[model samples]
Structures are given as C-alpha cells and as structure tokens.
Target: MATGRPYQLVVFGASGFTGQFVVEEVARVAAEDELRGSLQWAVAGRSREKLQAVLEKAAKKLGKSELKSEVNIILCDVSDPSSLADMAKQTALVLNCVGPYRFFGEPVVKACVENGTSCIDISGEPQFLEGMYLNYNDKAAEKGAYIIGSCGFDSIPADMGVLYTRSNLKGTLTAVESFLNIKSGSEGSCIHDGTWKSAVYGLADQDNLRKLRRQIGHKPLPVIGRKLKGRGAVFYSNELNQYSVPFMGSDVSVVKRTQRYLHTHLNESPIQYAAYTTVGGIGSVIKLMFAGLLFLMLVKFDFGRKLLIKYPEFFSGGHFTKEGPTEKQMEESSFEMTFFGEGYSTGQDPQQGKPNVKICTQVKGPEAGYVATPIAMVQAAVTLLKDKSSLPKQGGVYSPGAAFSETKLIDRLNKHGIEFSVISKPEA
Candidate 1:
C-alpha cells in the first residue's frame, strides 16, 4: 500500500503452473504500462531454483531479457511460518497463486495480515474464501490489511459482469441471471489437475461450508423485488440456443457476498443472482448429466476423491489433465458471460409495480483458466496499487465486487484484456 516496502508485490507461488502464468502477466503488464513498469515485485517459493526457472521461462516467452535479473526471488514456503513472515514483511501486497487454497492459503493470509500486507488470491473454493472472511476479516481490518479472494476466472467475470449491468442500467436493478459460454478453438481446452482436485474436495465438503456460514450468522439480505426463480438442474436456454447447467464455480456465493456488502454497507439495492454455463445441445447435456452424477458420487468419499485426483483426465473425461492444457489449446480458448438483468424503470417503486426495464451485458476474455486468470489477478493487483483511495476505508476480507466496485477496476480490465460491455441498451 506504500512506497517504502522493499518490494511492492510478490507472486507467492511463482513456480507452480498458474504461478508461472501470473509471473508472465506481471512481466508483460510491466513492459507495456509505464506505471506498472515501475513496480518493485518479487517471486517467492520454497525452491529458489524453480523460481529462477519460472522467471527464465517467462523471460524467454515474453522476450523480456531483464526479467530474470530484475525480478527478485524470495524463499518462502507454506509450511514455514518464519519464511512466510519474511516474505510478507518485504512486500506491500502478495499475489498468492498457491491453491486449492483450502490447504495452503491460510498461512500466507495469516502472515500478510500480521505484517499488515494486503493479499490477493485466485481461489475459487467457496469454503476457503468465506472461511477466511469469518476468521480474518476483523483482524485484517484492525491491521489495515485487505484479504481479497477469487480475483480470477472463477467469479470475477460473473461478479463484475453483474456490477457492470447494474451500473449501466438507468434504473434500480433488481435481479440478474448470467449465462456463461466457454468457446474453444481447434486445439480444444483443458485445465490442470489442481483445479480438478479443488473441485473434488470442495464438492466433498459442502456440509462444512454450510456449517461455516451458520457460524458467521449474518442476517439475510432484504429482497427488494420479485424473487428470482430457479431453472431446474439442466435446461435449454432458448436465448442462447444452448443447453445449460448450474455453474459449479464460486460465482453465486461470491456475487451474493458482494451484493450483501453493497446493500448493507453502501445502502445500494441488493441484486438477486444465478449463474449457469452452456454445455452445448441435448447430447452434451446428457453427457454432463452422467458426468455430474458420477462426480457427485465419487467426491463424497476419500478413496473416490483420491481416484478422482489421481486420474483427473479419466474422471473428468479429458477436461482435466495433470499436464494441463497445451499452449495452443490455451491460445485457442476464450469465454463469454452474458448477464440478463431485469429491474424497475427510473422513478418506479419496485414494491408497487412490476419491473419494466431490461438490459443485457457481457464480460468476455481469453483462455479462462490460465490466460485470463492471470490477467484478472494482475489487473486487480494493479488496481490495488494505483487506486487505493477507491477501496474501502478500512481494510478487510472482501469479494472482488465488494472491494473493486467503486474502483476503476472495470476500466482497468477493459483496457487490459477482459472486457465488460453492454450488449443491449437499457429498455423500458
């Protein structure tokens, strides 16, 4: 948050698969933007050699010869409190790329908060993200350290897409339904096993998340308008002409948290939201059903989980692999999330009349898991550094929307790669 730190930011898991991409993004952004070029940042991990290798690889790929020498490497490990503390003390912010986060995220968070260093992560695991807020929000606020989670492909597009729709509307926005479409080029797309493992464990532990929420015990947000209806498990979306299913990512929980924050803290009307992802036509829907059933059954047991993790490609039907997607596959893949919003026209009392306004907006970007994930993560970090005054006065745990809604995050993202656009003008 200040200039006195030895380094302004640190990518804490620089040797991991996604961490490498984050390193490249920081390097690329630094080279392209004059302000970002001035960033004093470092890469951190248990192995300095591996960190050096990541930097070297990034240097070759990004064609930035100075990256290897310019970027600092910090020796930090999740298991080593002193190392984490040391890493935390040296940086103003830590862009944590370590995940499945339920296992490795807390130590970095604890260290950052204790040191008054803000931290961010691309974690999509709902239990971990919410648990951090319940456990650390107070301490983080007391220490003036912001702990923000899900600053990545998982929910940023969905969460911020809803915000974009609300901001663009000329009336009081009431509710939104987002349909996510991921498109792949000839090479096709697949994600790493890390994400698959996280999903497996997260699905396995839903009860604990429910228990954690009960422990938090905040009052329910007021429903300002007609309740949004659910579209059963699998359904055909006539709008997009694709069969869709409920998204399994963190968007619903994250967006709802943001909406709650806005309604409670900012005195804004809360928006009811739902998220779904397209799965092609009826055949794909059937495949999805079979896969979903098997996944649900398998994730419920420890042995089944191990099998799922050990054989991700097989279990996920080639959607997840230990080796991850090829660069060509990553290059060819992109995603679009369309938000359909309904609300009352300006000056209309929602309690008195049926909604009369409608708007459609979209957030689209490159390959979701690796490419756009790093772009969003790095841009969020840049927003933190460059737009401090736009943030909440007191630092605390926050969702991307809660923390960045008032910031120029949408603009920054638009300028970078992930674009938020109004597809249809507000209509009454």
Candidate 2:
C-alpha cells in the first residue's frame, strides 16, 4: 500500500444521485493498491445527513473493515460562497456534481479558481460552459486553476478521440465527423432534471437563442448536418446512413471550441468538425419528426415551454447503477467516430497530393456512461494533478482535448479499461 499524505479529492453535491456514484468511484479506486496510501478524500453537499449516508454506503461497498477508518464529509452549499470557499481551501481537487449549472456552477467555480484548486464537472450545457470560458479562462489561468467542464460521457470520448486521431495524422486536419451510439442494459432513469432546467433557461432568454444560432452558423458544417450526398440511405457507412441530429447541447460547441483551440494554440490546423446522434431507417425518421414538432412548438405556441415544466421526469430521471449491465452487456454497447480530413501530407513537400483521411474507433456497448465517465474524469483529475507544470499556468476554463494532449489522456483512459482504435481511407 502506497500510504502517505493523502491528496484531498472532494466531491461536491455528494448527496445527489450522480454525486453518490462519484463518491463510490473515488472510494473504489482509493482501496486499490496503486491509489490506497495516497488518497485523502471527502464528500460534500448541502445536507450533512445525505452526505453521511453516501459516505456510509461507499464505506460499506469497500468492505468497511478493509478500508480506512472513515471518509470525511463536508457540508458545502453552492449558494453560500463562504462555504464553497472553505471547501475549496481544503481540497486539492474538486469534482462538482451539482447541475443545471446555469444556475449553480459559477460560484463554485469562482471559489475554486480563486483558491487555485482544479475543478471538473459533468455539465453539458453549452451556453453556461461558453459563458464560463469567456468569463473565467483568463482569471483561472492567472491563478493556476484547471476548470474543466463536460468531464462525463457526453463529450470526453468524442473530444479526446478527435485529438487521438489527429495525433496519427502529421499534418493539419481539415475536418472531423464524430458519432455516439449508446445502448445500456442497466436502465432505471438516466435523464437528469438539469436538461429541463437548461431548456427553461434557454426559452426564457432571447439572446441565448440568437447566440446559439450564430454559433451553429459559424461552423463549416452544422453540428447536425445532412448525411453526405448520395451514398444512399441504405448502409452507407459502418456508423449510420441517414442524417444525424444535433446532440443538442454542449457537445456541439465543446467539440467545435476544442478543435478551434487546437488550431489556434497547438496545431494551427483549422479543422472543420461536426458531432451528432446517428439514427437510421424508422428511428431516424421518428427522431426527425419529433425534432420538427419540437421546433414548431417552440416557434408557434408555448407547447415546448409547458411540456418542459409539466414533464420534468420525462427528461430527467434515467440513471444507470453499478449493477446496470453485466460484463457481456457492457461488451455490447459501443461508440464510434469517423474523421474526414483534407490537408497536405506531413512528410513530403507541400506539393504532395492532399491526403484525405477518414478514421474511426469503436468500443463495446453499455460501457459508454457507467465505465467510461468515471475513468475519463478520474484520469482528467490525475492529469490536472500530475501535469500541473505543463498545463495552462493560469486557468480559467478549458476542454480536455484543447488543454491536454491525447497521448497522456488516451494512455490513462486505456490503462483504466477504456479501449480506443482507429480506421482510415483515401479520398476519392
């Protein structure tokens, strides 16, 4: 056991549903030989009772006798800056599970950035994330704080996957296409009320709607673009044949901003990219129809607004438990991304033929959220801890792919059991 001064890893909102899983993951890893001696962690939430319950469950899962005497519990409310500051002061790193972040995240982030503590969250709200980036990126950089958003299954795989593929291609990448196909065996309700909260926020703000439209238009190809011309809707690629829909949140802007940052700060590649949910046949048609209806409702009546408020559970309750999918079921759930790049070759002169590269990677199923998220986040936290010297010295807000290289991230994720591979083709 590698025991020493434990690195304090605090989980905020530990009493919440997702927060509990995060706490359990930290406990599980801490019990392992590689992580045992060096782990000193605490769980925080507004309710001390709920936080204690979470800690108890985690301790029990680790076989109480074999683990440490007890994990610490901290009560920190997002609404209280003083409490948040105190919590930040204690932890070297913080994993924020509080969401509908447009409302609750800024203060927590402010506390961490000012305290020089690194922070990560599962927020998938674009406007909130972009707002954070605009407001905090500079201050964070000045204070040496690494504030990373969307540290979950929503965008990490795709964002980091693009970085991985680009690493293999020596020259600038002109474009990239990414897709996510998820099938989880363990199903209770994974949807979070956060989605409804965000939708309501967007609906209330006319400026937000305009900003989103402008952002979408800025892309060479929209996040959800029409299926490439005429391969026919019948099995055009291993991914999907029909037009894909915008993943509808931060995945769009995060991926785009990531590629933009890579081009600006690191590679100067100026890559064009888009991300979407791949659907085909009746599934694709149904999705399109639903989207159309939703759009019309938003445009004409207040149908969308009423539905969001009245049916919060319809979008917010599906969460996967550890017992969700069996090993075999996990093997069946997978994700894939195809990179379409047009740029000059790396080795030969600029005159060499423009090589168009198409690369793809697939992982087994149901593992998307359960197995992948915890690993990605933990690895991201570790990277923030271990590679502090090389990272953006002054931190505000950043995406993993933009701020960190794929080599370190992919290596860490792979070691933790996430598989990554690639495929390529010559342009016609």
Q: Where is model 1 more than 4 Å wrong at Cα?
A: none
lDDT of each: 0.92, 0.65
Candidate 2 structure lDDT: 0.65
Score candidate 2 by TM-score against the native: 0.80
Per-residue lDDT of 1-428 in model 1, one digit per residue for the tens? 43578998999999999999999999988876556558888999999899999999999998888988999999998999999999999999999999889999999999999999999999999999999999999999999998999999977898889999999999889999999999998978999999998999999999999999999998888887788999989998988999998999999999999999998899999999999999998888888889889989988888889889999999888999999999899989999999999988888997777788889999999999999999999999989988999999999999999999999889988988899989996544
Q: Residues 313-413, candidate 2: write the lDDT tens digits.
A: 54322232222344455455555544443444445433344443445544322265545666667767767665666675456588877766633777767
Specify the highest-lDDT model's number.
Answer: 1
Work out how many backbone clashes candidate 1 has.
Answer: 0
Error in Å for residue 169 of model 1: 0.6
Worst 10 residues of 1 by lDDT: 30-39
Error of 1 at 236 (Å): 0.5
Per-model TM against the reference: 0.98, 0.80
- Note the residue pairs that clash in candidate 1: none
